[model samples]
Target: TALAENHPNLLASRHQLAGAYLADEKAIVILKKVVEMYETLPEDHPGRLALQHVLACVNLRDGEPERAVAILEVVVRNAEALPEDRLNRLVSQDELARAYLNAGQVKKAVAMLEDVVRIRKAQPEDDMNRLSSQHYLACAYLAENVVEMMAKVVQKGPRRLVS
Candidate 1:
């Protein structure tokens, strides 16, 4: 606490602490505080955007998907200035899709995840990010009741899974 107070801008430490607290019910409070500190940074600053992403994840975990969507929307928009293949931009897009899913916007999630999956497909098939995006795309399809899409994803098999 003293360290946080003395070095409020020490985002790396704050982010680490927030991660450690995520399993606790009070995680939202701690993450909110960290996000507040990050507000002092520029809107597009990587640290600020990364903290916002974490906050959005916490919101999703707490069943506050609307809040997660709101936060992730901003993060995704800001991240657009980054290169298409940038890790942060890709991650922001993926999380935004997840937020959409949790918010019950299955169609939107499906569309976004499809795009993410397409991008990830350009990476090595063994890439974890590609596999993760494909998995999420399948989940979105399942949520949308697109059984054919889900089946295709499943048929891709584990070895073909991207990110």
Candidate 2:
């Protein structure tokens, strides 16, 4: 904690600590402080965006889907400059879709997850990210009463399931 306070520019320690406490409510406090420290950074700065993403996850864990959605919306927008295959952008989109789902915006979640699923499809079928997007897309479809779409996603399951 002292080190983090002393070297405000050094986010690695603070980030790790925040991650360690993510399951605890303390994570929100820690992450908020770290995010504030990075306020001087540009909105699209990778470090700042990454911190925001973690903060959003903490919000999600605390059942504050609206907050998560707000943070992730910005993260996604800023991440547009990154490559399409960048893990951070893909993961941010996935989390944002989840935020929409939890906030009862089922249609928005379905639409967002559809894009994520489409992008992940180009990756290896068994890739964790691809599978996760597919799973969430299924959930979104289920929530939106699109049972046929859900069934189609299920049919395109990972190789192990297909076998």
Candidate 3:
């Protein structure tokens, strides 16, 4: 709790502690507090979406997949609404897709990822946005192991990303 005392609003530290506690049975209170802190933050805050993703992950680890799914759904909706920052939205979408996978909503995860892949593919090859999308999509693909596709995705990292 030293980190929390020093930086109460620090999202990453809170998320890390919650993640650790989630593996134990004594985590509900800590996780709830972390979620509360994050929930009060403005939607567009830098760590807002990341906090939500962590909360959802904690919920999943707690065997509360329904709650995790609900949180992720809202995250995806919010992501879709933020047009000025499409890359941020994409990151949220990627997190939501992972939530879906964790909740065993495989179909939803695949469907969401299909769109992510399409959008990434349409980006100008030299754009960082395309590279990020590819990175996340590749991660999702590896998570699902979609028919030996990992080889193709694994090979594209440095190539897709132009320094």
Whole-model lDDT per candidate = 0.86, 0.88, 0.68
Note each model's CA RMSD in angstroms. 9.0, 8.9, 11.4
What are the runs in model 2 whose C-alpha is more than 4 Å off?
1-9, 146-163
* Lowest lDDT 10-residue stretch of candidate 2: 1-10
* Tens digits of lDDT, candidate 3, 1-163: 4455325556566667766776675566766666677666777555666667667766776678778888778777767767734777776676677667777666677777778768667678877766765665566666667634655766767666565
Question: Which candidate, 1 or 2, has the higher lDDT?
Answer: 2
- Model 3 segments beyond 4 Å from truth? 1-16, 19-22, 25-28, 83-88, 101-106, 122-163
Candidate 1 vs 2: which has more TM-score: 2
TM-score of each: 0.81, 0.83, 0.54
TM-score between model 1 and native? 0.81
Best by lDDT: 2
Across residues 1-163, which tens digit of lDDT does each residue of candidate 1 receive?
4455526556677688889999987777877877887787789988888889989998998899999999999999999898888888999899999999888899899998888888777899999999999888999988888656677889988667776
lDDT comparing candidate 2 with the true structure: 0.88
